[model samples]
Target: MIIPDWLSDLHFAFSHRGDGQMSFKHADKDVVLESRNRFFHDKGLNLDSVVTGELAHGAEVALVTEADAGRGARDRNWIEGIDGLVTDKPGILLMTTHADCAPLVIYDKAHKILGQAHAGWRGLASGLIESLVGRLKSLNGTGPSELHAWIGPTIRACCYEVDRDVADRFPDHCRFLAGESIRLDLTMFVHRELWRLGLNPDYVTDSNVCTSCNPEFSSYRRDGLNTQAMACITGIPE
Candidate 1:
């Protein structure tokens, strides 16, 4: 597992290739559960206390509470239509699965609020980050400047070629042409978006670990539909 140093003092983690397949979508239920159990246990977290999003690649951000714990730990009944989750409730982990999509971790230290998001190309275009920040503000008035964020491993521009349709969704500055290939820099897009949202650039960190380039991560672009996935998990410890 890759624990971000920027948020190393907190209970936050990004699963790695050797952490086993964290997603249940393409794996056996019991096997996936076992993997998750072991992973969470190793991190001093309880799998039964975790809440995950359905990850529809939409803009929906759900405000989670203690009652929502373990909703997706053993089954697929996660918060529906949610690509992002925000909560101030301690001990209930917010997690989202990813193959190559970017995993976002947001924390409001003053209010003790947490936000977790899965930002694929579609999710970013859908304004998922905006919705998540808005939810954080509503929860306890945590504004963009007060939020600290981390963008985890994903398919970086070096490997993320896109068609015109996908390229048009973001600003040209975040996309560039490598010869004839139009590649999009997801990290750059996310960073610029956060800056536009009024978040302090110093408080935001990007892992810069490209999933497609790094063998330690699972990449859909590299492994296709049969690829196993990693997961991003974070929470406030009691």
Candidate 2:
């Protein structure tokens, strides 16, 4: 697991491969719940206080409240059709699952707002980051400059080879060409998007850990259909 030091005051963490799978979709429901509960408990948190996204790989972002907690903790009843979740309430954790896809953790410290977004290739293409920032702005009056963000571990450009169709969606600068293969730097794309939205580049931190290369992370590209997932959590203390 990674606990970033960039923003010390907020409660944030990205689970690693050894942390066990948190997604119940492909694993046993009871086992997934047990692992999730243990993980939260170890961090002095409770599964019941976490609001998870449905991870539809879309651009939708939702503002959750304390009442929405535990919506996806033990069952599949996640916040439907949303890939991003944000909350300003204390003690309410926001979580999103990821494998090769990057997990984004955003915090508006000034407003005490926390958010997590699942940014897969499709989600990025659909402008998930923009949707998330827009939600924070509209609901909490939090601008991009007021936010600090962390791009969690993901399949970086070194291992993110894509087809011509996927490469065409992004700019040339975000693509890396090696021999005949085209690789996309999702981390860079996210950073540029955040900058375009008026967020200060200094406030954005990338873990720089590639899931595909690191044995400690679950990578869909590496493990294929049998891949599990890691959980990303962010919140305020009670």
Local accuracy of candidate 1 as per-residue lDDT tens digits, 1-238:
2444547866777778888888888698887887798898898888888899789999999998999998988999888888999988888888999999999998888888889899999999989889988888887765689888998989999999999899998998988999998999988989988999989998888787899999989999999876778978888988
Provide the overall lDDT of each model, using Cα atoms, as 2-decimal numbers: 0.87, 0.86
Q: Given candidate 2, what's the lDDT at residue 208?
A: 85
Per-candidate TM vs. native?
0.95, 0.95
Q: Candidate 2, TM-score vs. the true structure? A: 0.95
Between which residue pairs do clashes occur in model 2? none
- For candidate 1, the lDDT comes to 0.87
